[model samples]
Target: MKKSILNLRLFNSQVHSRNVESKEKWLGYLFGPCGALLLNAIMATYLNVYYTDVLKLTAIWGGAFLVMFPLASKIIDAVTNVVMGYVIDRTRTKQGKARPWLLLSAPLVAISGILLFTVPNADLGVQAIWVTISYNLFYSFAFTIYNMSHNLMCPLSTRNTVQRGGLSVFNQISTIMMSGIVVALIFPMAIMPFLGVDKSKWILVMSFFSIVALPLTLLEYYFTKERVTEENVGKEEKKIPFLVQLKVVLSDKYMIIMLVYFLIYTIGTTLKNIGLVYYCNYVLGTYNDGVTQMLVSVIGGVPMGIGIFAVWPLAKKFGKKNVTVVGFLLYALGSAVCWMAPRSLPIVLAGQFIKNIGGLPCAYVFMALFADGLDHIEWKSGIRCDGMAMSLYNIIAVATVGIATAIFNALLSGAGYVAPELVDGVTVAAEQSKTVNDVITFSFVGLETITGLAMAGLLLFLTVEKTIGKKQQKIREYQKAEALARGEEWEEPEVKAAKEEEAFFVESEEIFRQELKLKCEKKGLNYDEELQKHIDKVSLKRKKEAEKKNKAKEKEELRLRRIEEKQREKSARLTPEQRGKKEEKARIRAERDEKKWQEELLKGEAYRAKIQAALAKRTK
Candidate 1:
């Protein structure tokens, strides 16, 4: 039962490393994401401003680059993560299957984090294009490493549902925390100085601020331990060809849903966030990034922090799907309000608060929901697929992000806004102004529709509530106990089947009852006391079924009758003369039913004879 003597020991030989694992795991998740956040703060939020205002790139092209770079990570994320996931599933490593992926990739993530933000001071034309290509490549690669391992760790860290929820929630807190630092601080400090607004050394200033994200990421690797089993890990797995792997991964329904949702939500959100800078500058007539970003942070930040906690509790109570639907509907509503609101800052701020409140619960739910999929699939197939599954999901998620970025970039270009060539002033073509408005309107409406789709997906999740209920916690414990006895890691279908007979019996009872009745219902077969008892059993069951069905029919009839009565009253109002005709038809229908009952009475003898013949054949 100890960690060492088990079939696999990838990450650690120690079973009780709460002390060592605690801090190390915490930091591993932190450093990578925080670093990514700082990088994104520079890429997603500030880069457009820097290109337009400082570097004087054209709005169309600059916006295109800004949107395309981070978005390109989607393509990079899809392929890399799936490969890594399959590799992890098939890998045999002493450091643990996932740790190697993380350890090797962690530094890359940090390096890429820095690269994405570090722009060359070369002239606008060539350098802008080069920077776009380079930043996206680095980000795509870095996030692939970080997001895969980070996600894999959720399943690896603990098997308990409650513990998973707790872990997922806190990690999201890390997401929010890092997001705050990225948008609120990193953007203005790193990109603004070079625009002739401040005299600070932008490069060193950014590196210093951005480098702080690394230690936080490294912490995740240290505190977290990978829990692997022989069943879960396979050094000799049939390495799937890339095309086959891609096909199978895409076929997973849950993965596709999450993928689409991520694409829509991320793109919509990015458009809204990036557009805020433009909205404040031109529409509201202010260039103060600090005030605008601060206001956004307060509106968005506080709700996000609160949402992480709120979602778990509400999901536990009402189900994760219900809460997510409600949350998204709120998001849809907020999107509409903001789109229609006049260019007043107060109205916009109010809209943001509403949107943030609606979005908070959903942001945390999808990550934790993956735990449910891991259990349900294993239970159904007896095949361990968390690695490939996670990879497939991540790839789609990343790709959608790519498309969103691409769309936003295209929107900006079509708007015809040119990036500011001079140090302190930006030139806006009429097309640019028109495009900005269209982008805003599109974002508000488009995101709302996606939210509706998200709600529909959440409904599909409801069926699992009963079968998998309260069993996620027990399943993990059972996994370890059975593996200990069998000298393996995961449970084979035979092993899992032993624990599932209770469920099988419950499902099969009705069929068994019917078979028993068929044998008992024989005539002239020298029936004994045993036959009599069985007949009693079948009769009682028949009575119960009939009673239930009759009750349901009665209720349905009552509802229909009420509806018909209302129709009758409404029709009478339309044509007073038609009322007598309607009453005549009702009387004819009653008389027809009475004649059918008399006919049934006349046929009773024939019906009894048929029953007798059936009994004789059953006896024969």
Candidate 2:
């Protein structure tokens, strides 16, 4: 049994190493998020409705709790994100850093998700406490672990940028399909009418979703390969300090831009999602059944689903930022049209379809954008903070959802929207007025429109796409330099191949020289003189090659110097406070660089000691 287990383990290792090269591996990556996001969509879209309608939480309490609880949890979640990132970065395991977390988190997330919707029969205050505890447990802690790990899988899966883009497309398609299933089918067709908004029924539905999600997570784990992560498996010195990683990632202009764009984008999408139920119920007069919600979801989801395929190719052609900007503009226009349209179902559906069409680029391509930003961070800082980058990405996404929920709740409460009471397992909804309907409309259309436009404006500053090739080259150079500095045997493929070819030529040349020497001796000629001539020729050729290399190095250094000089000149033009900020940023970067240098130095010493010990052992 022991031998069999060992053999199985070795077989798994062999399969994992080859997974990245397998074209079919994308099936695993594509389906991994399906089950997870199905549950996620339900929670993000319907939890508020459940709280207000089924649990009978007052609008004021619901709004305040949703806002304040998540806001308070943000501090903890932020710390958790960063710490989890560092933990993943430092983790050394056969399963890889990010994948192990996915396995651990799958069951935890499932259990916590069920608990989040499964509050006991209690008084209002008691239920509020339960909701807070359960929500913080699941979303702030358990889900963060899962989400951060899941997102970091992209960069770790493969280093090929084109493959990364393909993965992003698959991810978006999965997410859209999941959203459609939850919003268009499950919530409306199964849960709403059949389950009748009962708390117990909601719990059952959540439990069912959670159970289905578990196996998918395992499948995802089985299918994905952490190729990039495998390369850094045993390199402890490669792990940067959390503070330094945070500083370097945050200091990146493109990172900040992507974060802001995502924040605004999340706020807009969250508000629209939260408001959709209310809009259908109050504004469209479909409170009795979830037909309008289903209709809107199906209408929006179809175009968005179809549109995702176009996004990858368009992103490749026009760049992710440009495509996203265009998408946002179209989305804003669609929202404006929705705001103006009458309460006709077809018109509303039409607007929704258009809006979803416009949202495709941002929805489908932002992960790729974030991945690009991570590369930029790695290129600029000489470190890959996939953990830190994805952690902050998760935080921004979660925080924006909270903020959007808070705003939605506040608006609902201010508009005099009332929570329904559960009597004998039936929810008695309040009679909503025009003010409530108007608030829902504005929240769904007006708010989304404004935020979408703001996202477009902010995204115009993004210029990362143009210089990605150069940045990637710099990252390769940095990696090679770091490897050499630590006395490790690492080289770029081209460089290693070139060196091997040169060595082969030198060996052949020496063989030829020996043959020539024998001939010279046989002919009673000056053998030493012929050898000297051959040595001079080879030496002169090496001199020319060395000079060429030196010239290339000098040119690169001059280019970098000019860029830095221009930056310094730009800094000189800044105001006093801005200049102070710039100086502080420079100090942090210097500190990070110094720490990196010390790590390399220590690694070099350790490597030398290792070599010396090995030599001593061999001699003995």
Candidate 3:
């Protein structure tokens, strides 16, 4: 039995499972961003505050310079990002496209992140020059590479929607809970109080994160697999020109929707993160030294953490877009609650908790939805858009930080916001005027309310999921045709996935048997008896897990049932003519969806033919 189990394990290990979910992959995804994002969260949450208060940049450069600097700097990144995306798409190496870039970015991010924080104590002109160069170095160059490559990993790693969703969950958790929560709660609560206005201590703190980032990034690169990227290996297909590919990606309506969605969400969150310090210092009645901000972070972070687990199941049940819409509504509702009493800590915390809960579904599943849009574009265009789509995605992710910061600084400076001053011997926060306080409050909560409502409405037009589902088989056929034209054989993704799943069961059985055999040997017991006991234990555990899942499913069903009952009651109140018109509208909508699907299918066939003919002519 032991020999057979060993043989089975070896066989399973030899059969590579592309896009199959595994513990190592999930861990890599989770740990990859921990170091970098932790540093970034710290910067996003505090760097602006540090510049305004500790460095006293406003004293040197005019107040308008603060607003113009970040916005102007992002213009460089915006252009750089597009060029980098084009370069990444054409780049081929033994380490794969994105991983090689990920590796190169590690040292760059580490060095630049530290330098950005370590602004030298020199002449005002020197300090300003140092800040500009370091800021651009860290954000425009290093962070862009890291962010783009890390995001590209997800779509390239898998085409399987379920596995993609799982990876996305881990990615979001790492960004939100691991990096975000720690920075939000711990940094402000513990570190900020200690650092005070000490620039040397700030450099020390930033350097620690810079040191941590290197190893974590290497681990992520080592463990991540770009399965979809591997699909193109040894195939000599026609390469689309950079400008043309850019046009293709930009013109995809789904990509546009995702870009807009991402921009609004990032801007809203950035505003909150940058404004929270000011809000706590001024609007909350006193500079309680980040204790109030820490409390607020914890209050909000806890619910967001819980909502992470629920996002996947809820998205699976109700669709990603539906879950996201509900989240936006909740966000708006929570913000409205906060608006009722902006100065009250308890009310603010409660509203923050509610708003954070609303943020979870979108935060967790946006990448997955964006990946689906990428797939849809591929289905239509017969090429992948990993680099192009993700570059734009990173642009929004990074640029919004600048946009938010600039907006906050502009408002604060305009309202005669007072920075901390050295009183007697120690630095103390200055009391702000009422207008400054109001601006802080608006940045903290009001921005989110408007963006949330706008996003909820805009997301209604994102219907790529429905189209992608209909075109899945056609996509596989196009891929096969393209590969055939290149004189290579192609295997269906579903077929490969099914084989891997069978190997998974074999591996599982082997492990269970090996463990049982070891236990029997140790105890001087019968292997047969131990095996039977182990099986029974495993069965009991499975039963309990199933019961838990069933209960959750029933609760979801009950909620849906309530919604349906409300709709029925509303329908009963309508006149017969109104009911008939509603039915006609539903019919028209269904017909329109069907018409669009058929049109897309026809277009896909034409594009596939062109690609195949072009490949054939080139081969000849």
Candidate 4:
């Protein structure tokens, strides 16, 4: 039986490891930022040029279309995310949980993103509408579907928190690298030329970019994994509604805060994106200055990514909230420096370098707290609720980007910059040539202001209290163990309730988990290795332990029944012989029961000791 149990676990572990490599997980990671980089750079940064210079549309019309692309998509993105979240929460597959949608959405997303830019021919209004509808459809369905299924890959379906964190890091790096290539390389090389001359060339360049980015992004959806396990899954009979899921997620303080942050930040992005082309063309007097803009893109990321590494250590030392505060301050200060720095190219570059280099680290890791916040809700509400939690994050992110563009367009039009009518492939006359620079500069300053405000909103997110330090984590881990002992899902509600009821015990558990975690970190032991060892050792004996306990309970009940029977016999006047015989039987049974209890107690203690020892080894 022991051998069979060991074999079963080994088989399960093997299956889990295999499941970890599902195509969707990696593919989604690769696609999300790469595609974001490509689409945003083109649509946000250069689409105005395409409209005014290439297609020969007026700024009001051109800007209106570009703005509406994201705005129109915002509604669709939200609707799609809610729908996908609902569908994913109810998803099941023999291939393993959420893999079906995750695997399938790649091609659809790739095609839609490409189609938005690759449309052949149509009337201007119709073309604009087509682009708007197509972009919205692609991102709303394809991106949301892919991301919802992707987040399900967390919770160690076949791995652990450490593994998930590692994956997050890997995904961040992979996506950012692609962003660098797309924004830094692609724009300087291709789009700037398209902007310089020839309306026909604009379409040709966009088509080329769409081809390059679409395939690169599709590779991500082709490579990611989706692992599966027993989870606090909503019942098949009582599926969660889309609106309810959206409502619940939005109700979360962190989710609301994230939405605010993204919304505000998107405003900054829109201004910054529009500012880029305008600054190069009108302010700096050459679209060929794309290099400086690319520099800005590269600089923005370096500091943020670097800052992220420091966040974990600082979080361990202080708290997630404190570290985030420090990050926000550093990032904001840097942005201020970059924005306010004088017109010297060297000075601006220096400011940009410092700001981005400082900001990059935090961007990579600190936002993980957003996901961690869901644990508090799970503990409080007894729902794992990944789809709702993650969807909220994505929705805010997508919506804000769209919102930013709309705000930018409104401001641009208000500033009296009409789009140039195209003459062949070039603008017939400059656009608000005299005042465009002022608009560009003022808009940039506003961008700085909005980004700063959004970062402040991110600071408020620390209030959620899901940032479990070492102490709380230990307590939760023990309850998790207890649930496992009772043959319950580790993430189930009863386990959380059981732990919540024992405050002192929980405090001690947390202290223990912390000390051990610190010790492991000091020893440089990987969390994944420790977790894998534990999962490999856990067994069906959890159910067996519950059964043995139940049997012991039954024995006590039987003993009480015998004692009551003897008392009844003794109550009869002529029943002395019967009472005496009953008493004798009762005494014999009691003695036998005592012996059995002692033996079982020893076995139980031994079993618990075995568990403790294994846990110690894993943690140590």
**Reference-based lDDT, each prediction:** 0.58, 0.75, 0.80, 0.55
- Which digits, one per residue and each the tens of the lDDT, describe model 3 over residues 26-112? 556887778777778888888997899888887765787788889988988887787778767877654456867787788888999
Rank candidates by TM-score, best first: 3, 2, 1, 4
- Best candidate (score: TM-score): 3
By how many angstroms RMSD does model 4 differ from the true structure?
20.5
lDDT, candidate 1, equals 0.58
Q: For model 1, how does the per-residue alpha-carbon lDDT over 170-236 read when each residue is reduced to its tens digit? A: 6666667766655654454444433432313445555565566566555555556554332344434
lDDT of 2 by residue, 359-425 (tens): 8987777777777878766655556788888888888888877777777777777777877666686
User: Cα RMSDs of all predictions?
Assistant: 19.7, 15.7, 7.0, 20.5
Model 3: number of clashes?
A: 0
TM-score, structure 4 vs. true: 0.65
Mind giving the per-residue lDDT tens digits that candidate 4 earns over 542-616?
466558779977997998899789866656754778778877998999898668656644653454465445445
> Candidates sorted by lDDT, descending order?
3, 2, 1, 4
Q: Which candidate achieves the best lDDT against the true structure?
A: 3
Off by over 4 Å in 1: 1-32, 57-77, 121-129, 185-202, 228-251, 424-435, 444-466, 469-620
Model 3 stretches astray by more than 4 angstroms: 1-16, 423-425, 493-595, 606-620
